[model samples]
Target chain A: MPIDLDEALKAIAHPVRRDMLSWLKDPQRHFPDQEHPLEIGVCAGQFDQRTGLSQSTVSAHLATLQRACLVTSRRVGQWNFFKRNQAAIDELVRRLGEEL
Target chain B: MPIDLDEALKAIAHPVRRDMLSWLKDPQRHFPDQEHPLEIGVCAGQFDQRTGLSQSTVSAHLATLQRACLVTSRRVGQWNFFKRNQAAIDELVRRLGEEL
Candidate 1:
């Protein structure tokens, strides 16, 4: 299915969330080493720290990104990890080119 | 100056506005010949008619697009003419690829 453009745009419109995607794109360069294997994703704690946002605020932002399919989340043990969904992002680009 | 990605994304998020850009892309294909020459651009009257939206609503949407630099307008005689700003659109695409 095509990614919902409206929802994706809404998710991405916020400045911090937009920066979050860019920052997460290069995890090795930007974030601290994860307690779990970094391949899984960066832990939400790291995002919360780097973003200088409260845990609740970071969670809300990540939840929005996940809802839009621009970001994916997984839980290991008790920590939540987030990584970009490249396919969905590319699909948004494709749709914008075709429809806009 | 760089196009404001946040504002542009927000402007394009609306479904009707998104379709408006796509429809305006090929004025000859989508709209009737203008009372004014077609070379300039499509008149807002036609857009209002085709969109099945109130004139005020269409104007508000167009204003947002204009503010985002996604669309440009010209005035000749009394009618308002609107056309896509491809450069701004390309800039938006570039920003999305690099930042998203």
Candidate 2:
């Protein structure tokens, strides 16, 4: 099924999620460097630090974004690296223009 | 003050709000005829009918949309006519492209 706009909007409604997007824009600047910054995005630990939120809260927020298709993640070792899903973001804008 | 993306996204997150946007796209088709269709958008009664929600609920949803700057309203007699805020919607898309 196609993603609902309401669900997607709700997922990104939190301030932390917005901050996550900003941080993802310049991962190296906002987060600690990993072994492969290019291959792996920011880890949940780094995201928790940047947002000053509890690790569980950050994890929950990341899960929300993942459900909304706003971000994609890759498992590297015991860490999950997350990067903004540019295609999904672009598609959201396109759909809003068409639907709204 | 500039609108926050998080706030706006939260406001439009409700299913009723999304339905409101869809209804506003074709007011006459979804809503009952009023005195001035062009001058005023759909009223609460018509909206309540289309959404099958309580009047108070529809009113609250409209208020949410208004807060998000996704829709604008004009008072007509005892009724408030709400229309989609195209400019604000466009600006939202633009900002998402720039910021997201």
Candidate 3:
């Protein structure tokens, strides 16, 4: 599905959510201790551990980003991993260049 | 002045505000009736006349965009002309590409 501009903007509006995106962009650098291979992206537990926030809070933020199509989530056994949807991000920039 | 990512995102979150940015981007095309020269940009009244919205409401939206550095405002006589700050907008896109 195509990403919605309004939803993407609203998803990244929060500071924590924005930070999460930055971390997700370079998982190897930001989350070196992550056990899962970098190819699938970081797991939800890593975010909970790194942010020191409640699991529910991290889940909510991740849900928002997923809903916006900014990030794609994958299930590996019991954990959900997330990575930046580069195509969607590039599309957003292109749209902003043309529309904004 | 640097355009803050959060502010710009928030500023463009609203549909009307996003449309205003689009209109400002091509003033000659979108707002032909604007009395002011295209160089200085469209005046506040043009937005009101074009959208059939109240002056105060338009002013508020303009203020939000200006605050976010998405648009630059110039005062000519009693009218405030607003134009897209292309450099700032580009900077915002670049930041999103790198940070988001």
lDDT of 1 by residue, B18-93 (tens): 8888887888888865677777988988888898899999999999999999999999888788999889988888
lDDT per residue (tens digit) for residues A1-100 in model 3? 6679899888887888999988987899888998889789899999999899999999999999999998999998999999998898888877876777
- Native-contact fraction for each model? 0.85, 0.90, 0.83
In terms of docking quality, model 2 is medium
lDDT tens digits by residue: candidate 1, A1-100? 6689999999999999998888888998888566677799989899888989999999999999999999889998899988999999999987887778
Inter-residue clash pairs, candidate 2: none
**TM agreement with the true structure for every prediction:** 0.93, 0.85, 0.86
Q: Which pairs of residues collide in model 3?
A: none
Runs of candidate 1 exceeding 4 Å displacement: none
Ranking by TM-score: 1, 3, 2
State which candidate, 1 or 2, has the greater lDDT: 1
Q: What pairs collide in candidate 1?
A: none
Tell me the lDDT of model 3 at B20: 93
**Candidate 3 ranges beyond 4 A from true positions:** A36-39, A76-78
Worst 10 residues of 1 chain B by lDDT: B30-39
Q: Write the per-residue lDDT of candidate 3 for residues B7-99, one digit (tens) a residue.
A: 889998888999998887778889887666879878999999888899999999999999999889899999899999889888987887677
For candidate 3, give the DockQ.
0.68
